[model samples]
Target: ELKVEQNPLFLSMQEGKNYTIYCNYSTTSDRLYWYRQDPGKSLESLFVLLSNGAVKQEGRLMASLDTKARLSTLHITAAVHDLSATYFCAVDINNTDKLIFGTGTRLQVFP
Candidate 1:
């Protein structure tokens, strides 16, 4: 089986609201990463979790990783129209630089 899983394939939020996304993996990995993609835009790196209990944040988004449980989370503090996009998390396996990505989380932030 592939290594990663993410819930709520789609989400919609009102402006100024908040939500959280979950990611789970099946195997041990060297790192986990979060990325965002806006319409017609390339993927933008959000967070890189290198170790257990790693957490990183930028703007209104925060990401955390727990290797013991093989899980990761992305929390959105407040929703905005500009934040409407797709979010993805990936796992970096031990033998390869390639990442196994979640199906994707499509978010719509209504203004």
Candidate 2:
């Protein structure tokens, strides 16, 4: 069975501060993906870490995956209130496209 765990289920930071969200899985996975969802809104794709040591960055957010350790991280740099949202990490088990998502990390940034 595949299980996913995320740390700091909720995060509150001041604008321009930095923080990181972690995701760990119990088994091997073919790919790791990240998503963001605003309150009561649909999810939006963020990054897809396809290999070990893979990293992707966009704007103020960056995501990396370490397959050997079954861990993925989403880092926020110079956070802003606009970036506030719920972030999730998902895994494609055995490349099956069946994604198991973490509980989610709700981030709130204040000025």
Candidate 3:
């Protein structure tokens, strides 16, 4: 069975501060998987990892993965209220279409 775990399930930080969210998976996965969701909103793709050591950044958010370690990280720099949302990482099961998502990390950014 494939499983994904996210660290710091809940985070509350002041605006301008920085933080990181981690995702660890139990097995090898074939593609990219990062998403965000605001309250009552649909999920949004935030990052896509095509291979080990892949990294992507947009605005104040950055994401990277280490396939060898089965670990991925989403880092927030100088956070703002707009960045507050639930973040998730998912993995394909044995190169199949089946996916398993991590327990989301709900972040709250206050000014």
Candidate 4:
């Protein structure tokens, strides 16, 4: 068996920025997967590309993309810790209509 953990979400950034979205999975699998989510958008797949060298993304989680290179990396490894939380937006009805932050995480693990 392989140790596993789940965390939320993804982000887009320019240069001189850090990546907070962490990835974790077994290191001995024959295949791997990497996913991300953008604001105002749905889940997106960073995998499944066509050629090599051509790439995409907006954050420090950057890498080359080319199917020919078989180098279309999936980046399946833990970043820092084994757990993470993605905070969301919420309305604080008690603070005179103040705004607060919340976390809603959904983990999908296959056994």
Candidate number with greatest TM-score: 2
User: Would you estimate the TM-scores of all the predictions?
Assistant: 0.94, 0.98, 0.95, 0.30
Off by over 4 Å in 4: 1-3, 6-15, 48-60, 63-111
Candidate 1 to truth, TM: 0.94
For residues 1-111, write the lDDT of model 2, one tens digit per residue. Answer: 899999889999999999999999999885999999998999999998899999999999999999999999999999999999999999999888889999999999999
Model 4 residue 47 CA deviation in Å:
2.6
| Model 4: per-residue Cα lDDT over 5-92, one tens digit each | 3345443333332333333333222222344444455545443322335444433234334333222332322232211223222222
For candidate 3, write residues 12-62 as lDDT tens digits.
Answer: 999999999999999887565899999999999888787889999999999
Residue 27 deviation, candidate 4, in Å?
A: 7.1
Off by over 4 Å in 2: none
Name the weakest run of 10 consecutive residues (lDDT summed) in model 1. 1-10
**Winning candidate number (lDDT):** 2
User: Which regions in candidate 1 have their CA more than 4 angstroms from the true location?
Assistant: none
Q: Candidate 3 regions off by >4 Å?
A: none
